[model samples]
Target chain A: MTAARTEDDLKTLMLLSLDGDEGAYRRLLHAARPLLVAYYGRRMSGAAQADVEDLVQDTLLSLHARRHTYDRTRPFTAWFFSIARYKLIDHHRGRGGRKAAETQLHDKIEDDFSAESLTARLDLDRLLDALPPAQREMIRQVRLEGRSVAETASSRGQSESAVKVSIHRGLKALAARIRGEA
Target chain B: MRKTDDIIESLVGDLKPVARHALSRRFLVAILSSLAVSLVLMLTLAGLRVDMAVALTLPVFWIKAAYNFLIAAIALFALYRIARPDGDTGPVFREIAVVVALMGVAAVFQLALSPEAVYRRLILGHSALHCPFLIFAFALPVLVAAFLWMRAAAPADLRQAGFMAGLAAGAAGAFVYSWFCTENGMPFVLIWYSLGILATGLLGLLLGPRLLRW
Candidate 1:
């Protein structure tokens, strides 16, 4: 389920904002509000809605301060999500300065968040499905599971070079698929 | 629920961005100006290598210069990318690794091509012990200048940002040092030059959390 806002719409609004269009900037933030809520909502399920709202506002303020740093050449979401991720990491760190316990909780939260809602939000599975089985499996193992090519190669009984090639080609194809060029 | 309108109101009320186009310009100014300072310092303090006239005529000299310049350029590109909150250093890192690996190969190739006794001489140049320190010394000014400019932006990954700053400064320093350093051996560049860069990178890593706290 994609947000009601399309990537194009977000880009258009951001472009307008960059051009000194304050109205467009407001509208862009307005448009982002619900998506941001949904974003924080999913990760922070069972937690107070206020916490999610606070995080959303925090991210928006951060975006304001950092807007100039945005490169016009790159995708807005990559820039946006990275900011969100940082804020989330900071949020966790601030609340859970309990040290060792904090890392476990953070990892658990990350896995829980990404496994379902995040994957669906990004449409990762559909893109993966479009790839050939070998490439798809390669991407899943290497990219998703964070397995080394050497390890994956040994397990799959393939040469390390072959594994590396597959991972490279797989990611390239995935990017093409995301761009609708596949 | 708190009103989204209120947040929007607060954001738009007096929000002036640092200016979008100005960011790139600022970065360019930082790198160029710092590099200029480093170059001036090197020229004044050490002067060019004694064989400067002879070295300028050699293709190997140009090749080595190209290698150092490319490393700096690549690191600068990486730094520029990560200047933004969302910039990813993963791909840039691979490119850097590939570049360093090629340098290693070039060093080995130079070793193999040269006579057997030349190995020790190439690896341990007259200035082998002092080259890394010199490079590190040159890198300091660039690193400080870079961090000053970089502090204006809000980087999410302070350590990485600092690391990038260090890498960029180190590369720039090495590039400048190439003029003063008479050592042509690839091993000298690979070992001493890299260690110098690494030292700066470590310094950046150490300072990142403190400097880029925001």
Candidate 2:
């Protein structure tokens, strides 16, 4: 597909996903993976395949977590590539790479990727599984199950504020896990 | 590692419509509420200038208030943009530079038009020693509020975001304190007030990587 057509397609999928269309969201992620893989592969030519795949997965996770920050009025590709570039720079910085080279590379990757084909694998269930049962349960209900805090609070015999705090702390802990701090 | 497909499945399993403009709303609410707190704090601790009616009638008082308010407004705009994952802060930085340069020009003009005898007094008002520190102190609540809300957002450059947060809080603090500050010199506001805002921004820079890791 042409770049303009691809941008339109992804933008439509993203809008649909934001409107809570599961099918559209899945397609969006699926569509994003290959572009991410190709993008990372080009930058990290000397890195292991697993490392590149990990970066791709990390980028995807960040995209999922930060999807709400995407402004509908902006180009979808710009938003996607910004997150991708951030993760790339973050990956290098975490590994003690040269700052000047990283910045030069950053400028080089300013353009968005064209549609391409590739495959990769990764997971988050392990991190979730490591959380305390109560925290895990709270996160699952409010975050994954789409339940209101009040409903979860009532069902769990806890105050609404307590449920809110639990979810907040739980998410914080989950974030710590993602950062490898826990 | 688990399958990427499985991860995608889990993510899509229970998707919900995120509230539109939620990020900006949270940021606005955070800054404004904390500003209100700082105002209350200043009122309780120092009270307004003794000659409030007289101060209100003077153009110098409004100039001081406007100087601080303008910085707060621009810095807040920068903070808002930097809080987003894809938000660019380049334009905001240029805008802030423009505001500061304008203030610098105003200070120079104010000095040139006045007699040289009072230059020192104009620059170093009675509250010179405490003004910047007090501005920093009043900014704490707003800084904390900005940081707390910012943790929920994805800022690409943590230090830059933190600096903007501090800059915003500091200018806001100065603006709130302007009501109680009796100093009517443009040089005093430009120098001491800017120092306070710079100190807060430095503090934010130091704390960004640690407190804003998420």
Candidate 3:
């Protein structure tokens, strides 16, 4: 079956929007709305649908503001998730630190296309093996499984901040390694 | 970490297309450019075939123009529909090159014979550039090649979801040029336009691998 809406499609639309096509921007907003609703609803507990709706509106606004940072020709979900994930973190950080064991995190960045997709195309399983376990795990849990930092932290018994920090550092390290800069 | 490209690209699908661009503008440009070229050539022919020059204002002149534009538009539209902007272009170019190289040979033969002498000859004209030989033997095929290569390499990336945009543009350009053109109805438009289009297809086939290689 055709896979879910991928990111490249979104990138194309965003680029078109940048080129003065309001139509593309409209498409981008439409596609990202559902994602925002599901994202906020899943993470916020005891929160009403209105809360999620508010978050969706907020996320779309933020996306519109920062859409320039996004690159065309990449996956929309990954970028969208990255934005959503950041919005989620901002939400948590805004609410003061999480409770001792209840701290959760999620990342919406789509790092999968550049790495896993390329790996599959190149069939470089051996190269993937070269990554340190923690770094690789971060990549897998966030990029592959579509988990947020909060979810990963909750599952792994790590602090939410720690999870976010690790993911940030891990991706940096992975980039260095991939580019032979390590 | 893995799918940076995918994650980054995902934002666009979130977008909804709000408008559609018609092929007419680009088509008009094609017509204008081609006609400009044809007019210059037609004027040149006036020195030789004054009768033909007088006939240019006749409705038959428009028939030829319309015919060429239609032929180019259809071929381009088909190509746009079938082309996958995201799909691999390497193999596509390999196929295209073979076709173009063969046509290049035919274009050489076409250059040797006089279209006027064979089809509409009562006089002769010459040019260092932009002649029938130059356009058919050179410009036509070259433009075709460029059009195909551009699509295979880098499409307009406009919001429009069609692949044949370049071909259509080329047809518009070529059709206008055809308005000024005369071939030995020996090489009907089928032969000429097809050859021109195939040459572009071939160009894409030959160069897309390198031009669009990631």
lDDT of 3 by residue, A45-77 (tens): 774555666566666666654444343444555
Model 2 clash pairs are A122-B4
Worst 10 residues of 3 chain B by lDDT: B153-162
**TM per prediction:** 0.73, 0.76, 0.33
Give the alpha carbon lDDT tens digit for every residue of A19-101 in model 1.
Answer: 77787788888867776786677566485667998888888988887788877777666677667777776776666763633
What does candidate 2's lDDT look like per residue over B157-200, in tens digits?
Answer: 88898998999899899999899999878889888999999999
Question: How do the residues B168-200 of candidate 3 rate in per-residue lDDT, one tens digit apiece?
Answer: 434444454554555423224435554454444
Better of 2 and 3 by lDDT: 2
Error of 2 at B19 (Å): 1.6
> Would you list the clashing residue pairs of candidate 1?
none
TM-score, first chain, each model: 0.55, 0.54, 0.50
At residue A145, give the lDDT of candidate 1. 69
After TM-score superposition, the amount by which residue B16's alpha carbon in candidate 2 deviates from its true location, in angstroms, is 1.6
Q: With candidate 3 superimposed using the best TM-score fit, by how many Å does residue A78's alpha carbon deviate from the native?
A: 16
Q: Which structure among the candidates has the greatest TM-score?
A: 2
lDDT of 2: 0.81
Ranking by DockQ: 2, 1, 3
Off by over 4 Å in 1: A1-4, A45-50, A97-182, B1-7, B15-20
Per-candidate Cα RMSD to the true structure, in Å, reads 12.6, 18.6, 16.9
lDDT string, candidate 1, B99-209, tens digits: 889889989999989998888877888888888788888888889888987787767777888998898898889888989888888887888888888888889988987
Better of 1 and 3 by TM-score: 1
